[model samples]
Target chain A: MATIATTPVLPATTRTRRGHAERPSAFGTAILLLGVVYCLLPVVWVVMASTKNGSELFSTFTFAPSTHLLDNIVELTQYRGGLFWLWMLNTAIYAGVGALVSSLVSALSGYVLAKFDFPGKGVVFGILLMGVLVPSVILAIPQYFLLAQIGLTNTYWSVLLPQLISPYGIYLARIYAAAAIPTDVVEAARTEGAGELTTFFRIAIPMMAPGLVTIFLFQFVAIWNNFLLPYIMLGDDHLFPITVGLSGLLNQGATVPALYTLVITGALLSIVPLIILFLALQRFWRVDLAAGAVKA
Target chain B: MRIAFKAGALAAVAALALTTAACSSPASTGDTDGASSDSGPVNLTYWAWAPNMDKVVDIWNKSHPDITVTVNKQDGGDAAVTKLLTAIKAGSGAPDLMQAEYQKIPTLVSAGALKDLSKLGAASTKSDFTAGAWNAVTLGSSAIYAVPQDTGPMMFYYRKDVFKKLGLKAPATWDDYAKAAEVIHKADPTQYLGTFSSGDPGWFAGLTQQAGASWWSISGQSWGVDIDSAASKKVASYWGGLVQKGVIDNDPMYTPAWNAALNDGKQVGWISAVWGPGVLAGNAGKTKGDWAAATLPQWTAGANANGNWGGSSTAVTAQSEHPQQAMQFIKWLNTDPTAVKALAQIANIYPADVHATDSALTTAPDFFSDQSDFYQVAAKASAAVQPFTYGPNVNVAYSAYTDAFAKAAQAKQQSQFLSALSSMQSTTTSDLKKSGFSVK
Candidate 1:
């Protein structure tokens, strides 16, 4: 109860200390903009390249926009009764939900491991840390066999199930939990007679919210950008993620040059939501690596 | 608000649960007894990768009464193989009929993954097929795995206008071809007479077959390292000279350089397999009428006259529920003249059926102007094509050769390139021999 009263006071004092004005770092802003430009070059090329007809694509300057973007979209949409859109939807389902579940699992697992002394605690932590170093590509063959044994290969579960356990995600969450949640708060809640589950839900999760967002975004991008695992796992075209689907288009672009336009357009479209997500979530990124350090 | 967020999350989770519930469960039992509705009309599942030939399936489905074939355009060959391998490993999930490449059959068959088409009753029909194309589909003497779809008869295609401008006829031999290329390059500094992607040793393999060399033994067993062989050295030195002399516009396959050559019409001629016509058409407004066909320039006095490059086949997987139906479809697609003709028109493919039509040889289309009937030209070139024995380690070996060839081309190293190719071939041979192929 004393800590709960003081929590409101601490935030007000911190806000007052920051109320007047803070000068932005000129060099930092410039460096960040430079980084933004470096990343945006390829994306910008794809957007402009997609607009040109096959003949015009290589004929004109690489960046000079052309009139065929709408035509390319129409062609791509009609390629197989809007199968591209279906792929887009499947990818959204896979990445969006896969990341959500993975983030939740990471958060819950991390919170418990960080805040409590459970049985086999050290073993779990060590194993999860090792999992972070293990490459997903190495798991693809084994995962395929395991999934195939259960008759799960070629279905949506084939892709979704393997991606649900994010090792890096749990690692990040553990770090975040340790940094954000205070052991004293958990003890105080326990003294007030809150059950372990109740303490986790009411006290720890909210404190860990910002870190969880970072975990969610990290997992989201990892799953979204992933090509090899889904490419290896999902046999059905209808179940393909955008990366796999776009690469398929590019392969045909070898024989069918007309497909180049569709591939470029699809590539451009795939990255749009990702860029938006990053921009929207920038506020959660740590400004200083030491900002979360605690006082003794 | 907190309750609302949790409720929203719960609802999303519930939606996922609902969707997963709706997904078709992995078949609880193998569709083995041929049990999926002979009563309500048989639904045959066929898988292919042709983005343009979905209509061929629809046309076939509309034409057939007893069986309705639903063709699903799967991903590329590698993806399809990976899927099929997984399914084969599962012992149940493979499609009823699948379009596999002729080159892939050797590996697939050796793996014991495909249902023997000979068992499915296509043995005699497959025998009546063109020997070279059919050989590409067969795995050794016993197991006939796939039925040939189209024969990729290697032919030399030249830009008649460009050839005329350079005052040269289409070269009749490899030496002549190289000399003519040099002449053309000399005549126009900017225009090279020919270009080939060295990165794809498939053409080299075909050339080797033409020059009486086999890269691997069929039983997945032994390999012949022709890289250091007299004919192979000649082949490498000849092509290398063209690149070194700067007479050939070197365009690696699927690169911007290759695409630019097509768009600009810079290369005078290209030697490609029969399937190259479709590749030309697929490029649409590019390369239209700028090309004409001739027999693949042979190595003068070479043991073999011509050889196949790229072709594909259809086969029944071991997991197929209805092997008979699968064979029927493959037989109709490959050996039936009428079906082959229909597919040719729709897909612009030259049929694998040796007897499909002599007209397939001579029907002069305006696209090539006086390129004559493509079928007849291809038929002539199809002769002297010895069987290409694809080693079981063909995929890995080819990748090795490709890597070596790339480094050689870029770095100008010849001995290293030959050594790399030899090692790759020997490894493949050894792997195949271990896998039970009879390699001499």
Candidate 2:
């Protein structure tokens, strides 16, 4: 069974007839490895390229690292009175709070739409689905205009408030809540003299914690990676996220070539936190995936 | 849960505010101590994309301490324009003083985004600058919108070494230029005479402008669109013929391939503006001291006429709260010899003010190594650039025209080029009309 190479290796190894299917196919592994390399090539390039000084950046081969990483970081830190750190802090606030609130709202709404029979439930779900289809680029300018009407254009609320109503997060939450939590448990909690809200928070929420974690992670990464909304909403650079701040740096690099090294180093520094975050939250993601497999 | 989420959001906001205060508090990126000092009678925000403008602005601030002009750097041309547009539509966040490219002036003015500076004593500076530079910022001969800042009269920059080796003289007319293209390519098939990019409408507009094609003009009260004129079509066909024959390279400029081409002497010349010397040195480093500058070849024999490519003017926005102080700074920035001299040192282009050309600045660019006498030729060409008015939706028309022109340029079809020209004119006209502008 271990030597078999005729078909994809399957997890169901005890069945001899389908054992070859359980084996990982070389072609699939090659494709996935290629995907991983494709995703990481830019990260690796930034890490290595940030080590070179100004003149050496253009002169050297891209993958070759030099000894200017500390110098580059120092320059970036001194850039605009350490504004790169401000961008990092702003990004955390925008993504962290935005994801937490959005997940809470999505869980509540998704639980209601999934378990409770309410008027216009189908209409609500249809609208949520339609929201997922509408592109964010189209929404961003109009959002800017609407936010402008209330005098909140350059404020933190402008960027955070729009991202909190992520329709995709709600859609995922609904499917996950319906699959992960059983209706009998909700009825049993209600029958035990629990109110609807109490039943939801006490028992159903605990049952759906894995699903909510998945939603939170989804919303977190989405809000962190968002560029256009922040670029449009914020004029003050101090309020800018790392995406917009690095973009501003990269754009200015055309005139000032030395800023290119700063941009590379800034980019490498910006991603480390996100990698750490993904690693920290990765266990819940695995559990969610396993729960999803059982539900499937 | 809802209350907890609110608390979390509030806590995050509080932490961010603390961080912000720890690092300069609203003046993080070079506001020049306005909020802290609180001394100026008027505080004006200036949005400009030019590099090293702080020195120029700092000079002004030192002389006049009553008014403080805080500099906000925009990254590029398109982003700044988009930012301005959004700010104008939103009716807030517009900078008091912003540098607008000469071509974008009309589009911005038509949108009623810029303050009419003619009333603000803009007319007094009219005699101080060239008509080609001054006319770009003036609207309909009465209302001026911006101060003339810089000019980019097109000049022929060539590899002097390559031309000498090929026994080629600088072409004096468009006919001679076409002939030289054929000769250059026939001599060395691997190289092109020059790049004719489809992606850049500015280069095309400059050529058409030099060809005596006025793409638009104000007709009484309504705007006239004439991008499909015979003169423009003729210029298009001329480039099309060369592209079809494979004599001219169609690669876009400022890319890795174009840089390599210029560096390796694969492209013999670039018909660029006063900024060419600086850019050529910056990008094509290996070709130092090998290049020389000449005025663009005439459309008619011995005409000595040229076209302008890039220039910008500083204007006061309509949203500006303090227009008087704004104009005071603007006038001094453009007219004062001290400020202009400071600007010319690092600006890398010919100064728009006629008085700004001092002897020390004219010696030679280090990149050219004094071999070419580039500035003298560039100045002569600057005077010859015919006055042309850019249309009111200039940037919008450019994006649409670039797309259609790219298809035509790639396919090498004259009819396609003409059709694209017609469609561009029609679409721009109707779109402007739909946007409530009076179009003829």
Candidate 3:
């Protein structure tokens, strides 16, 4: 055994040095815990606060929970035949499908700018970068007028169409594609008689999958939390999202105090679906600045 | 795998097609309802803020079954105005019957968004309503715009028990009112004889109106500002002195501090409009049988002290298809004594109609206690109300005067107050001109 140990192909010195370096540093653990607590504090408060009655909401300490959660939910369900549920369904349709369609357009548009040598590519990229700074709210009134010109105001398309063009998503996709897809691999695929579209489908897309997941998540959350756009665009109550619906209930609470519980319960129900989606898809999120920096 | 994705895409396409098909059905059903493109049961949608309108709608819905009435409950004043302006710009799905507040009619009319209702059928009932109330809905001599629904008649409300304990009688003159405050404060170091809130523009307007000062005026081509008028200056100075002397507490609505003060009965009296009993009932357990009502104290003794505070009117929009049906509902809600009485049961909205004052509902005892007859007090105050012109920029003038008066009271900024008042007057005059109101 001593003679056999005389010559090992790999050196023990390098392996030992790497092993003794560190075992998950405490600083990294602390930083991650701090980040999580910062993000979840508001949500924790909302969950506890929803359980309290109106008097308890103001009288008790901020985060203390009371025994009114189920009672609040039942009262909210009885308000005008559960119109709150209609708002929830409307919000889901707006965010879920809106984000999905936006992701596809962004992915395809970004892939083109990254892989192809198109005319005026620099100018196109510059215009897209400019779009990132223009706030969505500023465009709402103008968008409303434009839609009204063709008689589309108060329609689902008025909201859904304006959100589809996400310039930031395109910018992210282009950056991810440039780093993730290897140039030599593309050349080799081409030499093997694979067409451009074929190579893109089989190779480039798979490499960009992780980055695309991050893009989809960003777009989903942005659309889910949007309120002002829908508020300005739609006039019909039946077409309102959860945010608008909850606000109407809150306004009524000013004159009638009993509606306060309904507002709180509606607010609680509104955020549950988004939280579940966030938790389930969280593992796919590559938080590293460079998700494409993997070794072949 | 590609075929499955294509199938999913096809399904989305099919869904879109179905929704498009569904939207067209409402358009086609219109012809069958005997609504010729022009004269069929015109869909007149009404937007009202008060809960009382719900009772009025139930009555109207039974009579005018042909006209489809969709009631959209909206907040009154600024919030409602914002929504209306946005809807008008959108040019579709506008409410047919819209409720406008007393002070907001001029601002709304100037925006060119309302129907010219001078020719509407409610014209004959104009004389029957209170003079001050009808004046708000009429812009000029010829352009009568809306049907008056409710009126606010200002009065002084006091805690009868608190007054008796302090051994003081309710003052009939402004001087006596001041003396009573001193006596009450001497009796209990904590309690003031009355309360005043600087933040409320409506309260400031009521004070100025009680002193016989017009907030806005139109003279040929220039507008007159009344912030510097002798009557207004006296009213502001008297209230400002009370604030400085520490005999009055300034409390806005719904604050924790305000709520606590209300429950403790630190303020023995309050001067508010016909619906102020609503405010009293809001704090039910705090002041059950302790309250009493009287006419407001006068500056020049035996003056017209009563002034309107909050009221509303209903008008049909130009876009409405069923004008007849909408008017049918509006007339019932505004002029009918039975309907008005039924509404008063649900909400404390005192009707503008003189006949409504005679209703048996007005004699109903207080729900909180049997010690007071609120409707009689409101009716007496209503009979003494004085009308003032609310120009196109009435709100702007109101804010200007309130801010100036508050500064003078809160900070002792006399020179600054005068300058601010003049500045606001000039700005309001210009704003009125831009809005096509003859500012002179």
lDDT of 3 by residue, B89-167 (tens): 5656457788777788765554444655544466777866877777777644455667888777777878888889877
Measured with DockQ on alpha carbons, how good is candidate 2?
Answer: 0.14
How would you class the docking of model 2?
incorrect
Q: Comparing 1 and 3 by DockQ, which wins?
A: 1
User: lDDT per residue, candidate 1, B315-377, as tens digits?
Assistant: 876666566666677777776666776667766666677776563434654466556566567
* Cα error of candidate 2 at position A89, Å: 5.0
How would you class the docking of model 1?
Answer: acceptable
DockQ by candidate, in order = 0.23, 0.14, 0.12
Report the C-alpha lDDT of model 2 over B1-440, residue by residue, as the tens digit. Answer: 23322232232223222222332222222234434433547778888767767667888788777898887767666677788878877767778898888888876665456776765688889887998888788755566779988777888888777778888888888888888889889989977879777666777888888888877787555667888888888888888778878888876666556765776778878877777777776556777878888888887897877788877899987677666678889899888787777767765546788876554256667777665466667678878888687876787678877788878878876677778788888888876676555666
Better of 1 and 2 by DockQ: 1
What TM value does chain A in model 2 reach?
0.87
lDDT ranking, high to low: 2, 1, 3
Candidate 1 residue B407 Cα shift, in angstroms, is: 3.4
> Mind sharing the TM-score for model 1?
0.84
Question: Scored by CA lDDT, what does every candidate get?
Answer: 0.69, 0.77, 0.68
